[model samples]
Target chain A: MTNPTAAMLVIGDEILSGRTRDANMHFLAGELVRHGIDLNEVRIVSDDRDAIVTAVRALSEAFDHVFTSGGIGPTHDDITADSIAAAFGAPIDVRDDARALLEAHYARTGMELNAARLRMARIPDGAALIDNPVSTAPGFTLGNVHVMAGVPAVFQAMLASVLPTLTGGSPLLSQSLRVFRAEGDMAAQLAALADRYADLSIGCYPFHKDGVFGANVVVRGADGGRIDAAMSDLARDLGL
Target chain B: MTNPTAAMLVIGDEILSGRTRDANMHFLAGELVRHGIDLNEVRIVSDDRDAIVTAVRALSEAFDHVFTSGGIGPTHDDITADSIAAAFGAPIDVRDDARALLEAHYARTGMELNAARLRMARIPDGAALIDNPVSTAPGFTLGNVHVMAGVPAVFQAMLASVLPTLTGGSPLLSQSLRVFRAEGDMAAQLAALADRYADLSIGCYPFHKDGVFGANVVVRGADGGRIDAAMSDLARDLGL
Candidate 1:
């Protein structure tokens, strides 16, 4: 059976404006593959409400799960939470549970739970809170969308809490063979192999290292046996 | 005047599967902003035809320019060239100019211009050839979408050639101030400042470093004087 599909929506002007190179998309991609959920797509948009709502709506409907990073902070540009609420057409306000979490964290840290800080407590109706261990602000799961922080540490902590609770399929298995040759040299063989095993995904990634060319043929599938078979055939045929 | 808006479509299974960390997005993002093109969105999709076509069409129509990286190489999974043709309903085949470039390069490198290698020459009709100096394969531009190589060097080289040919708006100028305060502490004031300087785009990005919280207030706009004025006001108000 196919694995559950996921899409990531990264919300930030910092990333889109080249002020920050995003780490969450790659981190989530690796984590999702390890968790047996196929990451189908990833969209990074600016801190615009319309962009966020449109992208989140599209991704939430297209995939089994949608993980968003960034814009859930206590700042003018941090509009992701409200935008998400608008996308689902759900009413949002400062929930007591979320406020208490923030309040307690601020109390312990000797910081004020002011108007801006309390923005973190705003949760959409009927959404489950995803705990953030790195920071006090809790992420939330509204419908199929899991809105998390943009910070790498906080986003990781939130995903760690959310992933285990969700249903996962068999982990995707990958087998690879490296050949010190140009992609064109083995492209035909790889194509034939891909055709032979239509269920498996065979990818040829080329590299230039030490003034030499090489291609790494990776075979990915849900079945380890299928991946093994494809890799074995590939390795033997390539004389490796 | 507002900059020409652009979007990026990163087509590859390697990136989505967590095999490769995409460097092209950040590189292109930085380049575009410097070139006065506002990068609005970036989408990373797997090597699927329907997904590629859908994303390319949407991005191409939504923005003034759409830059796509990956899937233009000589591999079975590299379906970007064909997909772009399908997206614009343009016929694709081995174009003479592209083939000649590939043929001459292969001849110089002493590599056979075989069928698989020849796939690089397949350019869509009514498209301008993008010179790939790093590698022999010529990326193409069909309508507003500029199909570029995924390799860092090649992508940069193609961009260098393409950027000069396009009309660019005034270079977006940015001024930033770092304040040693939590985002919540300064968020309300920042919001007021944003309202005051409605024409300029002000972004407050928070950070946690060395057991302290801080936020970087950045003002971006086509008018350097406006950006400078906003930053000065923010600094004065925050006592920074």
Candidate 2:
């Protein structure tokens, strides 16, 4: 659990081309932050197999964990499962566990589980199923990569199921102070304070208002006491 | 105007560490599609100067236009102005045009334009300033890279100003047909239809509901007639 490094691969043409406003990226980013995982990189690619395989391989190897969103549906563009399996050099088939879930879901509601629907049950060999409570189609974990749905609701539920399984370090704690001053004015003091509180990661987020300049100073650390102390010191120094 | 290729470079530590869920990516993606621009690649990097400079150069060279969001604030971490100038090998200083805007904004609102606030007025040599109606601190464009604020509102306003100035191709037209079948069931038909409409780009979006699988087939092209014809043929083939 040493410095959980993670990367996000948003696979969707709608997102890349701007047809769909992506809600999952923001949701996942917030989740990763709360779990004390460092999300290092994010790449949004179209629903292309070559691109998905290339990005999945590169990111999975580079980071401790890789989370992918979009694809894995019952559509023509939903080729993520097969592509990821191909990247991992594994054979993909209709897994019994996933098929069972699909069957149970269909049986309960009395619907036909057609071939198009069966595509959702396909899982790479030796992969663990990630439950999707929102939808019967389950996500899977192969190696360090977790393949989840693109829809915000289903993706979030799948992420929740997969998160508890991973090993995480101390949960990242943060405190923010909304200050009515420019970042440059707080630079010297903030720098000095950040330097003093070596354990905390101090960030200055500057925003513009109705013709006013202001910044939000965020102090993050694994230690709650350190973050609190640093934030208090920052406020005192800024005369907040 | 030939293809109108574009890339987005998101500069912010908040985004990299998953502290900020970026909305600009999706917004810009949709905007690019409407403007007849092809969004090829997207990279989210930290607020580090070297990272910003590196991404700016690579993306600006590779694509016809490179748009960046975040780290353009009046804070210490807002090093985008300096980094963009450095990437272009240009000198960065307080520009008269930008300064006038900031000074006038502060004067009208009766707020002090302190040194920290004035940092927002800095611009690179030969760069054009972008209007920020939401905030007084203007974004600037150096070479092909257009820098904007991270806030969704301000970023969108800046884009409105910048978009009209850029050369764009014919606006892309899109049409969609909703099908009540799984992706795999519709895969073969969708693929065949996509081949038939070779001049158009067709996408199949799948959604699952209460043991039922359905898809929305989207056909996109420059001509409305072509898009409608493709959708009509698709709907007939799917028996919808």
Candidate 3:
């Protein structure tokens, strides 16, 4: 069976402005691959409400699972949660369960649960909260969309909390062989090999470093035997 | 006048597989911002043909400019050029000018211009070549979309070659004020400040470092005076 497909939506102006390099997409991509899900697409959009709503809605409809990071904080620019709610046409308010969690955490810390802080408690109806062990403010899940924090630590924690609940297929296995020749020299052979092993996905990445031209051929597939045989054939063809 | 808007399409299986973190996006984002072009969206897709064609067509139609990185090499997996041509309904073939350049470079390097190496000479109809100073292979611009190499160095060179040809608006100016208080503590005042200067885009980024809670409020606009004034007002309101 084909693995469940997923998409990631990164919502932040910091990323678009080049103030921040997004780490969440890479993190999620690795984790989802490990969990046997095919991450088909990833989109990074700014903090604009319309962009967030449109991306979330489109990705949520196109993929089996949609993961989003950023803009769920207690600030004016933190419009991800609200935009997601609007995308689903769901009414959102400060839910008691979420508020109680925030309130109790703040009380324990001797901090006031003010209006801005309470904004984190706003959740759409029928949505479930994703736990944040790094911070008290929880991310939430509405339908297939998992809205998480922008902070790297909080986002990772939330992903760990949410990943166990989803279904997965066989983990994709990959093996790489480095050919110390120009990609042009090996293109024809590689193309023939790829045709022979149609089930396995072969990727050629060219690299030029220290006066050496080479390519790394990575083979990916669910069947380990097929991948192993393909690698062996490639090695033989390259005489390596 | 509003800044010209642009979108980026990153095409590669390595990025989606988490084997490589995309550095081109960060580099391009900074460069576009410097040139007064607002980077509105970035999409990363695997080396699948349909994925590349679909994203290129969508972004090229939606934005004033579309920049794509990766999959333009002499290998079976390098299908970006073909996909882009398909997206624009343009015929692609080995053009004499591109072939002559490749032949001359190969001759200088004492390398044979074989069929695979000659593959790089293929250009889409009506597209202008974006010079690759670092390498002999050339990138091209079809309609509003500029196709670029995936290698960081080559992509940077292609961007440098292509950027000066595009029209730009006033460069965006920005100023940041660091307030050593929780975003929750400053959200109301910050929201009011943002509303007061609606023309300037204000972004609040929360940080928890060294056991301290703080946020950096960034004010961005085309007018330097407006950005400075808004930043000063934010600093004063925060008692900084």
Candidate 4:
């Protein structure tokens, strides 16, 4: 059977404005792959309400799971929670469970849970809260969408909390052979090899460094034996 | 007047599979912002023909310009050129100018221009060539979409060739104040400040590093005076 598929939505004006380089997509991609889930697509959008709502709905419908990062903080720009609620047509308010977590944490730290801070307690009607070990505010899941924090450390922590609950399939296996020749020289042979191994995804990534031109021929598949056989043939063809 | 808007399409299975982190997006984002072109969206899709075609068509129609990176190499998986042609309903073939350039480069380098190498000469109908300073293979601009090589150096070179030909708007100006206070402590004040400056985009990016909690408050707009004024007020409000 095919592995479960996922799509990611990154929401932040800092990323779109060229002020921040997004680390969450890469982190999530690696984690999902390791867990035997296929991350099919990723979209990075600005902190606009309409854009976030549209992307969340489309991706949630298309893939098995939709993961989103950013716009969950307490500042004015943190509108992801509300936009996600609007997308599902779910009524959102400050839920008691979420408020209690924030309230307890703030009380221990001698801080007041003011209006702006309480905004983090808002959640959709039928959503489950994802634990945030790095901070007090919790991310929530509504339908198939998993909302997480934008900060790298907090995003990673949230993923750790949420990944164990999902079901996965066989992990994808990959092997590579580095060919110290120009991609143009090996293109025809590689194409014939790929045609022969139709089930395996054979890719040639070209690289040029230190006056050397070469390509990395990677073979990826679920069957380890098939991948081994393909790699052996590829090595023989390239005379590696 | 509003700045010209643009979108980016990153085409590669390596990216979606989590084997490679995309640096081109960050580089292009900075370049587009510097040129006064607003980057509205970015999509990363695998090296599938249908996916590439659909994304290119959608992004081309939705934005003023679409910039695409990856899947333009000489291997079998490099089908971006063909897919782009199909997206625009334009026929593609090896043009004489492109072929001549490749032939001369190979001859000078003591290499043969074989079938695989000649594949790089294929250009869609009515498309202009974007010069590649790092390699002999040329990128092309078809209508509103500009297709470039996936390699970071080559992509940057192609962008340099294309950016000068597009129109730009007023550059966005930004100023920032670093507040050494927890986000929860400053959320209320920051929200009030953001509301006060309606025209400027005020965002607070939180950070927790080395046992300290703080945030960076940024004010962005086209007017330098307004940005300076906002920054001064933010600094005083936060007592930074």
Estimated TM-score for each candidate: 0.98, 0.86, 0.98, 0.98
What CAPRI class is candidate 1? Answer: high
Write candidate 3's Cα lDDT for B1-240 as tens digits: 799999999998899988889999999988988999999999999988898888998898889999999988988888888999999899999988889889898999888888888889889999999999888899999999999999898899999999999998887778887788888989988889889999988999887867788888888889998888887888788787
Segments of candidate 4 deviating more than 4 angstroms: none
Residue ranges of candidate 3 with Cα displaced over 4 Å: none
How do the residues B1-240 of candidate 4 rate in per-residue lDDT, one tens digit apiece?
A: 999999999998888888889999999999998899999999999889998898899889989999999988888999999999999999999988889889989999998899988889999999999999898799999999999999888999999999999999978778777788888888877788888889889998999988799998888888899888888888788776
The alpha-carbon lDDT assigned to residue A64 of candidate 3 equals: 97
DockQ of candidate 3 is 0.82
Candidate 3 chain B, poorest ten consecutive residues by summed lDDT: B170-179
Instruction: Identify the leading candidate in terms of DockQ.
Output: 1
For candidate 1, write residues B3-23 as lDDT tens digits.
Answer: 899999999888898988999
Q: Write the per-residue lDDT of candidate 3 for residues A1-240, one digit (tens) a residue.
A: 999999999998888888779999999989988999999999999999899888998899999999999998888889988999999999999999999999998999888899999999999998999998877899999999999998888899999999999999988899998888889889989999999999989999888877788888999999999999999999999888
Q: What TM-score is obtained for chain B in each of the predicted models? A: 0.97, 0.93, 0.98, 0.96
Query: Residues A126-237, candidate 4, lDDT per residue (tens digit)?
Result: 9999999888799999999999999999999999999999998878889888889999988888898999999989988888888899988888888999999989888888
Candidate 1 to truth, TM: 0.98
- Candidate 3 residue pairs in clash (backbone atoms < 3 Å): none
Q: Worst lDDT window (10 residues) for model 4 chain A?
A: A231-240
